[model samples]
Target: MNLDELRTIMRQCGVEDGVDLDGDILDLEWQELGYDSLAVLEITTAVQHAARTPLLEEEVALLTTPRLLLERLGTLTPAAV
Candidate 1:
């Protein structure tokens, strides 16, 4: 997970051109991305497949933008038990 990966994931998520990914996702509403609940769910499914992990429903809800989503996923790095 890097910015490039985040951009790609967002492209897959249907983010239109001209939207900025450098800002806070929460500041951008769902309507800005042209997404409804179903589209967001589809993006969650795509991210799960791409990342090859199970993302909790709550986690998906927090993915309002590419940057934020990647940041959250980056925090999931495996640690020694």
Candidate 2:
């Protein structure tokens, strides 16, 4: 999924809380973004809905940031430097 899709999920999950999701936030930790474990669960649930792939708990725990989450979901294309 892309940032826009993730943003949509976050908004739908009631998670972002006004943070500038459009900003450079891919590297920010979910905790830094004010997301707790429950929030993370919510996010994963939303991702599962969109991707139609259920994440194992162990796998879900590894998604620490937006970039990591996108990578784990196997949705992010490598960026050109």
Candidate 3:
């Protein structure tokens, strides 16, 4: 998904206005933005629902930043038989 979509998902997940949306946040950790495990789960759930991609809980757990999460989502493709 695109950055706009990710931003929307984050906003829906209760990210405050204090968080910089336009600035570079790729290196920032989710916890640094005040997101706990539950918040991450909520964001991942919303992303999965929007993207119609099946994401594992472990995969979600490993996503430390928005860039990583976006990259992981970008790599999701249907397997061919």
Candidate 4:
């Protein structure tokens, strides 16, 4: 999905309301954003559903940032990009 959709998913998944995630956010680890394993699972599952793709749980677990997740999703489902 697009950046706005990614950000909205993050927010809905409990990211702080107005954290002002700048460009630097792309390099930050998912854990740094306060997402536990469960949160990641939920977010990735949501993304998979939204993108209409079948994302492996192991693949999602390997993603360390939103950019990485987006990139992976894009690779898995071109329509998502």
Best by lDDT: 2
Residue by residue across 1-81, what tens digits does model 1's lDDT show?
555554566667776677765554443556676677887788667777777767888888877755456556674333311
> Candidate 4, after superposition: displacement of residue 38 in Å?
0.8
Q: How good is model 4 by TM-score?
A: 0.78
Question: Which regions of candidate 4 are displaced past 4 Å?
Answer: 75-81
Over 1-81, each residue of candidate 3 has an lDDT whose tens digit, in order, gives 776788788887887658876677665889887788899889888988888888888888888888778777884232311
Q: Across residues 10-35, which tens digit of lDDT does each residue of candidate 2 receive?
A: 77766556787778778889888778
Tell me which of candidates 2 and 3 scores higher on lDDT: 2
Q: Lowest lDDT 10-mer window, candidate 2?
A: 72-81
lDDT of 4 at 18: 49
User: Top model by TM-score, which number?
Assistant: 2
Q: Which 10-residue window in model 4 sums to the lowest lDDT?
A: 72-81
Model 3 C-alpha lDDT versus the unseen true structure:
0.78
- Positional deviation of 56 in candidate 3, in angstroms? 1.0
Where model 2 places Cα greater than 4 Å from the true spot, the runs are: 15-18, 78-81
Instruction: Write down the worst ten-residue block by lDDT for model 3.
Output: 72-81
Clashing pairs in 1: none
